[model samples]
Target: MPPADIDIERATTDDLEAVADAWVRLARNQANHGSHVLADPNRETMLATLGAYQVDGGLLVARDRETVVGFASVTVERGSLALDCTRGLLSNLYVEPEYRGRGIGTALLEAAEDELRGRGVDICTLEAMAENESARRFYRQAGYDSFRIGFERTL
Candidate 1:
């Protein structure tokens, strides 16, 4: 599959539950790629979060005639009272393993970026699992350059 045929759109309220389910699968996929796992991710919580985000951000989904192939979650980062919201962050962009080569991820990402740009965002930022080489390559091809290094240790 090429990168020109995926159907991407903004998720509506009716798609809430389904989007929450997709978010869980995304977390699991990240875990599979050696990232941290959500031991008990709550669907209700995800729905509520996304619901609120629907007002402040935009949730995008990619589908192939009904089945959700992927989704992207984006929000304009609100700065302090002294600053403005000119930065957007793509918090998550996930595609199913089976749909990885079908252009779905690219579509979702592009849609989110466009959504942010429409809101006057000057820069878009996203974080990929350090262990997920595929994700790194994807963002790189999407024109993102590394600007930070994250570190942590068990306490």
Candidate 2:
């Protein structure tokens, strides 16, 4: 649970497989926080997508010794509005259940934000499951606030 227990670093191409696997787990976790059936991502497609953005942004990983315990996908994206504002999307941030209480998540998040800032992003946005109170609390503590509400229904 201590901040010094892990090291945060930018993931390299060699970490492709691990990043993909972690992404799958993060999708499952989000689904668990809400009522929904989340489909598995196509590994090949996901890998290419994550890999493609390496030049602009990247996957930041939290490592315990040589083992990766958590990761976050940071990317630059255009804001929804027509205005020309640079937006950084915190696409995914995941910490294994066993390491949830540690400072790993916070470290990865801060690192991702710092990376975005370095890239000239004017603002960064992240979303949490509407019903995941703890996640909401965590994001709030991480300097995020709610500005939009999304509605969805199973078809």
Candidate 3:
């Protein structure tokens, strides 16, 4: 599908529930790699996180008409040891499975870059699980280069 038909906009407070639902879906897809998964988030926590994103002002969503096809979150933060501190983090990016490969992800990433650049963010960064080769390729094609190795050991 052509991306021109899709409408992309910043998410509002009213979108909190939808955003939370999307987050949960994406999280479930993540590897269990020794992290606790909460089945439900209380209203207060959900509202607080979504509210914080709204205040930070960088959540963007792509909608095919009224249905949100994909969403991404961008934020400027002090980068960790490997990432550049001057860059904006592409914190979260996900598309509904049905919407994959239709340019929704591309549009979302472009939107994120626009928002980050508007804020004087000269660089952008994101991380994907090493096991997710598709995600790594997607990021690489989107102009991200791998610069650091991530390591973890269970104690």
Candidate 4:
């Protein structure tokens, strides 16, 4: 599909279910790449959060003619101690596997950034599972550098 075919816009109450479904798929897929999140078990929590996103205007959905094929969640966060400016968090960005390479993900990402920038956010942060090299590469190519690294050791 052409990039023009996809519409990126803020999610609505009507889009909550579709957005939640995409988020579940994203979390489940991340498990294969070192994520510890229990996607299925968190469905209720995720759904609740989507409701909040809707009201906050922080959730975006990418639709290919009324079917949501991708979505991104962006939120503003207050800095913790020592920091002066607020930050934008790109908490979620996912494009369906079949929609890969169609530029939908890039469109979603750019829209998310623009949403943040419009809110006066100058810096943004996102996370990609360390084992998900493809996601890491995609973010890198989009001009995001490694600002922090997390290390974990399971007991």
Predicted model with the maximum lDDT: 4
Residue 35 Cα positional deviation in candidate 1, in Å, after optimal superposition: 3.4
The stretch of ten residues in a row with the least summed lDDT in candidate 4 is 77-86
lDDT tens digits by residue: candidate 2, 1-155: 32786888888787777887877777777777883645374666777877865545577888888887888888878656775678889987889889988787888888998899998898898888898898889999987989999998778
TM-score of each: 0.87, 0.86, 0.85, 0.95
lDDT of 4 by residue, 40-128 (tens): 89988999998897799999999889899999998988656666776899999999999989888888999999999999998989999
Q: Put down candidate 3 lDDT per residue, 6-120, tens digits, no spaces.
A: 8888998777678778877776676443334453654456556666876788888888887777788888876456654468888789899988988888888998899999998
How many angstroms is residue 123 displaced in model 3 relative to the true structure, after the best TM-score fit? Answer: 1.0
lDDT of 1 by residue, 1-155 (tens): 22555678877787777788888887777787767768246667888988877656588878777776788889988866545447899987878788887677877888898999999898998998888898999999989999998987889
Candidate 4 regions with alpha-carbon error over 4 angstroms: 79-82
TM-score-superior candidate, 1 or 2: 1
Ranking by TM-score: 4, 1, 2, 3
Which stretches of model 2 miss by more than 4 angstroms? Answer: 35-41, 79-81
For model 4, what is the error of residue 25's alpha carbon versus the real structure, in angstroms, after optimal superposition?
0.6
Candidate 3 Cα errors over 4 Å, as ranges:
32-47, 78-85
Error of 2 at 66 (Å): 1.6
Colliding residue pairs in candidate 1: none
What lDDT would candidate 3 get against the real structure?
Answer: 0.78
